[model samples]
Target: MNTIKVFIVRENDGSYSSYMDEQANLPYGLVGEGATVAEAMDEWNRAYNDMKNLFEEEGKEFVEAQFSFAYDVPSFLLYYAGKLTFAGLSKLTGISAAQLSQYANGYRNPSPKTTQKIQNALHAFGNELSQLQLV
Candidate 1:
């Protein structure tokens, strides 16, 4: 499976758009846009397959590959806000709810330290959950 790194950008219209950061010699200008990150990812996958098929039909080398998506902070927040609210994330991250809300809304960017803090907290939580056993 070949993985493409996606860079998510928040648009002014409150939609998320993604582009392939490393095309690995593939054609240029592969982009996806939607109201949510998941939608944008689905769009990107469709576009990628369409392009790959076109190359194969044209007698060009088309390698079948599976893609895994990656999300940026704002996009992640927006996409998972239904599952985890800003307040919930703040509790886990030790970041203030107000700040988390700002980050979720694309009004502010988190510093590298803050980003690391959030990632670490999420990892810790995921580790704890992995150890759970049903009664």
Candidate 2:
């Protein structure tokens, strides 16, 4: 199955958006925007299905793909805020909670180096969770 990469980003107005970059190279562009991540994703999925139906009606070949959603730093932070507190994330990434909060609130953008730091930390945490066993 073909996998399409979809990026979810937080807009300056605190809304969310889901979109495919040009690199996806699809015949049509797909985009969705909403006040939250879930809504944006739902709209994006609906857009895809609507496009597929249009293609069928036009007798055109529609490419079937599974979408892999990736989140921008702010979006990721905001989306997971309830589960992962800034203080906890700070410990994992060795960054201050205030700095993390600034990033999450879109008051500041992380440097590439800092972004990588966060990514590596999260991946390591996920690896740890993957190794867990039940009693």
Candidate 3:
């Protein structure tokens, strides 16, 4: 599966907007917006498929094939931060729960390094979970 980087941003009105980076070769100025990051991502997928189909109908090759998305930090946290307690996330990320809570609530933004750390920890946890087997 091809991986595409999608940068999702929260709008001032509390909705979310997303777009593919230039490297993805998607059309310029195409944006997807919705009430949540997931919804915005769904909108983006619909738009991408629509464009792909339109290009195909015109006998054009859409260079961008299937894609797996990579979401930005705020979008990722916004969607999932609520699912785990701040203490739980802190235990996994080595960040203080208060700081994690601040980041989750939009009271603070994590530095790039902190974001990377969090992402790496989450990926590691997911990998561990994937290794689970029923007794």
What are the TM-scores, per candidate, against the unseen true structure?
A: 0.79, 0.86, 0.76
Residue pairs in collision within model 2: none
Where is model 1 more than 4 Å wrong at Cα?
22-25, 63-66
Best candidate per TM-score, number?
2
Q: Assess the local accuracy of residue 32 in candidate 3 as a C-alpha lDDT between 0 and 100.
A: 82
Q: Point out the higher-scoring one by lDDT: 1 or 2.
A: 2
- Flag regions of model 2 displaced more than 4 Å: none
The lowest-lDDT stretch of 10 consecutive residues in candidate 3 is 21-30
lDDT of 2 by residue, 29-75 (tens): 88999998889999999999999999999999999888999887888
The local distance difference test score of each candidate is 0.79, 0.92, 0.78
lDDT of 1 by residue, 60-79 (tens): 87765655566677767876
* Cα lDDT, model 1, residue 81: 78
Which of the two, 1 or 3, has more TM-score? 1
Looking at candidate 1, the ten consecutive residues that score lowest on lDDT are: 20-29
As for model 2, its CA RMSD to the true structure in angstroms is: 1.9
* Clash pairs for candidate 3: none
